[model samples]
Target: MAGNQEPLSPRARLAVTAGRAAAAVSRAAGRGSGSVIGGKVALRLDPDLLAQLANHLDVVLVSATNGKTTTTRLIAEALRANGGVVSNALGANMPAGITSALAGGSDARYGVIEVDEKYLDTVARDVTPKAIALLNLSRDQLDRAAETRMLAERWREALSGTKAVVIANADDPLVVWAASSAPNVVWVAAGQEWKDDAWSCPACGGVMQRPGDDWFCGECGFRRPVPSWALSGDEVLDPHGSAWPIKLQLPGRANKANATTSAAVAAAFGVPPQTALERMHSVTAVAGRYDVVGYRGREVRLLLAKNPAGWLETFSLIDAPPAPVILSVNARSADGTDTSWLWDVDYSRLAGHPICVIGDRKLDLAVRLEVAGVDFQVCESAAEAVTACPPGRIEAIANYTAFQDLRRVVGN
Candidate 1:
């Protein structure tokens, strides 16, 4: 592998020799075999190795507390529609995960990646994406990422000298504020329509004034203007029932933001706006994210709610009458060690409705439900919970781990 040269495929004949050598090194060093996703091994190799993998390709990095995966997929789809192939292995964001994607040379000229917030600085440092999309920053996995403000500062530092074209959401005060320092930044707001008024000024903690749905700091005088690109006009319709006719295939307000950011990124990459819209409109679905399924002659909707912000977005998407709703919580420290964040969620939204509780921490969710004044039942296991509920139209909300458990229960 030399300068700007694509690396050999991981499945190539030489891959066996490389795998054996890697296995020997791991064994001699007393390490476990690496984990795999999309049939590629994710390992922490030397940083210098990144130079050898996909040197000829331009990396497009998308980062956000929410919507990163959906947006990355959306942008990749547009690129593909315009005759550009893309390599985005399963929702992998870590540096090692990226290395794995490049292990198999992509047929496309561009590489679209959904990067995790904590790993953004590291990936940006090594990959130096040709373009970067910054989505809204909301409260999330405090145990893992600390404060959003801190993460913003670190991203700023990582992106300092990079020549990547930046496409950012103007609605998020944190994202807009960070974009102020970028070299070549293009602000993409959901327009005045989807602009949220309830936001605090990042600089002085002053009350942000809302001229309609748009927000600006009264004291500090920092205003977030509407972006040039948007999906809906000034009044964003809250799609309550089935998914709307938006350009994005995914449902929910958060996804609207994802569509907006992804479209802007595609345009920045020189994809025409009309072409971008056509490609985006062609998008259908992404895994574990608003992923709809059929099980035992019944429809099942699977959504991933990892943090409070993510939960809030997911909660608002369920509009129909509460029909046998099953809520699963994971107690394990790894899935979410403390599980204390449940208190922060607006469970009151489930108001006076029946909800079945299951998984490792059924009591935890039950107690929260009790506080919220919602009716509920508890089952020893997810299997019993699903079987206990009357089979008809069912709405299930489960955390990351509990989601997997429920999937097994439904025989998926």
Candidate 2:
């Protein structure tokens, strides 16, 4: 009994030492958000420890089916633009990662965290952000769950206790429904034409028809009200397409949706609408998510395809399949893990190819592309896939991962 007790005390002491060592190393490496830990990062922490860590954060929760990361980045930028210090390290949105991010910095007025769809409830319960931005909720990561309806349910639960002012996407039916309970919700709607993909109402099972790009319940006539800030346009112009424009740097309609949503949220925080728009124009792209770069003397664009709607939006952005597109799919326990959702993507939206396929799940993507009658060459690895394409011809590669396999290959 004495020997066992001796070991337990020593083991507990060692754990404390290890925790301190980790914190020291994290600080030395300039990591922040020491408070807001993510479940995906530290899966088995006891509730008390988790609560201790979270108590230090002034978290700003950001969730959406499509554009959380992009929108989160934009919000961070807007906050900075308006002379407020913000805590946001790219791609670190979970509780542990967000904690680490906050730890990296010491004096930020706000913490802008992009919350994972599944973990939204946990983070919301823990972080208790000053403000929550609910971007559009579309069908994403279908392999993780059966349907978007379930995600909507989880979101409703996550947002229930957030006394923070809510900025929601007025364009999405599912989001509008989920956030209906928030009294302080500021509805942000984009222009009518931008609401191209509104799904039907989950409550009444009614056909949700686009009444001039604004949504209306076709069967029940329940109107989805317009947003406070809306962007109306026929063609999304990336002025940077011709020249490196000093004002606005991003391209495509999906980007416009992201920029507009960012503008609205910034305005809600009292950043003037024009100031928000001006700041938005300064963003070129978010990394690994429709991020564009010059690689090997050719333009390389990365678009993350985790779900069907993301795929559709990516398809909508590119102009008729830029030459030598590379699509890599990897299976990770963190990122849905199953490739069956590949079937649901509108791969037919992309026509023609010198398309190269790569990843642990490359064969799955290859099979899907073949069945869909698209021409593609399967590569053994991501680097080889990039190598296979001649410089300048291979313009972009859209790779999926829960790990850095693709990033290591593309070197971006």
Candidate 3:
């Protein structure tokens, strides 16, 4: 067990063993990582297995529409400086997978959990985390995950009177509203690139006014809180007016924002900003995300972008024009059924690039690209897409399942 914590009940112990066995079986059967299935089996046998496994460790729950996995990984690495830390580094973020991760890391001193947006409250209530990182929330899986405001309201209701220290994104109005009720909060000015979902105030349901980077609700007094930590250009400014350059192996401003929030969360756990940032710099990729692999004799960089906000951030991370871009999308269960959010992305930015579209939802993407006045060719597979482009370095952006498919094809 972790530290000097009490031992789990015999039933919980049995549940953990069963979960691990099930996970092994799943892996042997050529299934996925089996974290979720293992978790489900454990929960079925002992519904309170998660609480038992998490009781001994200092837990940090990270939730966001984007960067949850990367931020969780970064926080875990930073916390490792203090002692042993465990996390769902594979991005299996639901309750089942989270439970599996905790059960597997029962001996670790710290638990850094990447939680699904919808399951944050449920997981937090069970785990009783020491710190919670609320990154920016945007429109994601609208058909399944509900609207952003509703999710924020749930977070607000769940976080009210909580004992955990909330490290929230101050620049994101939705995140501000969600973490405002928490007793202790460390606010970070993590920039929000996709403002399409946050136009209305979550507090007053009034139109939000944004002049420059600041935002306030005119109808209500709710506004962007003064952040203790702010990201200015390429550097992150701490509360004491000291600036630290964010030189992470990860790319884009979204990742920089995630790193900033991770540093704050780590600081809450008694780690210094310098140490946390230094540990985070070694993380080159999250799961298969941001991995550059060879395909059809070309170096292809893989980027995952599920929703509009994710797509917007991914676009900034890709190589510039003349490098060619491969856009892939899928309407799998993991990726919400409705592909309407495709229209929300600004694909016009890739106008100059030799764009190739592939995946289950490539036709829908092609239609959207046509409306955006961007030229694109439909492809059957990632291999086909890569071969079509000129041999050199190329960028491949994909949604959930499509990214997995591309990884399989690229053998990453």
Candidate 4:
């Protein structure tokens, strides 16, 4: 439809039409956005629909354990400086949802895709992206997704000798190893705050040696690559040794790292660093993340953290003590059914803060908090949690489904 270069077969056209109809029905029924279900119906009718829809547009796939949606949003915004860009702005990173997004943006010249960590290879094989951004990989949805090393190995295999420019995070050992096999790579020192999953080398399975910010494997010769783009404090240094300040409206160092990666990917698409950063700065919130809403006469900021690495980054983003904190968790199918990852998060960080816990898995979180010697109140809902806190700005951090639940409750 949008890329009319090579016409779709009659069956493919029918599949697209059917998918749109299903999506509209779903929306009318108030089930959900209908992207995933629509894409599923389309793909079931035409299994090759994704490749067909992606044929004419330049595609860029962003994949990681965390930050996929935000980075994809930033990249899409930056690429808009060049031309029309279509993306799954919702947190859907699987093939079905991706197909729905591409089909919907038929007039877009570029497609920026946010791919789930495990689905990266599958999406890449289909879309034949112009560039791939490999951000840091850590343990996430372990019950459903493969281990970090296994995922990295798959990525390395998928990217071997790829024609697409691979923009990778050099600071992430697993990411470096995965992109090592790619023929074209642009390394960026985006920084990794959580290193629990990357302590061993993906190449040799040997203990990794980290001396300051650099990492290497003594058992094997694997090591961190010298990045062409590096983030230092609040500025990003381009390959030309030019430093550009990362002035994004997004909060936390994690977002700064994401912004840096976004700038590099934008550069690959011919957008100047300054222009891309300028465009990115306009993005205040991403898919309800960092959205501050008034609730119970208190400002509640929504933050999503799905795994250990994500929780680590989220801890840094929360407002300090007096602001109060609400932590919510759920182990629904969308979120991994395994709640064991709770043990890995350092809930002790909220030691001095007024803490409130809610969600389906509040008991699990409460136990973890109790073990950490943190004071917290178990609440049945976000409203109760907010009511327990003093009237002021409140930070609400939640896991996948819990975050969505909180968003609905807050009407954001």
Q: Write the per-residue lDDT of candidate 4 for residues 356-395, one digit (tens) a residue.
A: 9999999999999999999989998888888998987899
Candidate 1 vs 3: which has more TM-score: 3
Clash-forming residue pairs, model 3: none
For candidate 1, what is the lDDT?
0.67
Per-residue lDDT of candidate 2, residues 1-412 (tens digit)? 0011112234333433444456566667665423332322232333333333434444567887667888788777777664544454466666655544543333455567888766777877776666787776655544555466777777777667568778777777877777876667777654322233356676677888775656778787666765565555522222122111123466566666666666666665667555666676667767655555565566566767676666766666566545677787777764667677688776776667578887778788888988998888988876677777777645444535622566555656
Highest-scoring model, lDDT: 4
Error of 4 at 249 (Å): 0.6
Clashes of 4: 1
The models' CA-based lDDT, in order, is: 0.67, 0.62, 0.90, 0.91
Q: Which ten residues in a row have the lowest lDDT in candidate 2?
A: 1-10
TM-score of each: 0.83, 0.79, 0.98, 0.98
Candidate 3 lDDT at 334 equals 92
Residue 53 lDDT in candidate 1? 56
lDDT of 1 by residue, 348-394 (tens): 87765457788788888889888988888898875566666666666
Error of 2 at 2 (Å): 51
Between candidates 3 and 4, the one scoring higher on lDDT is 4
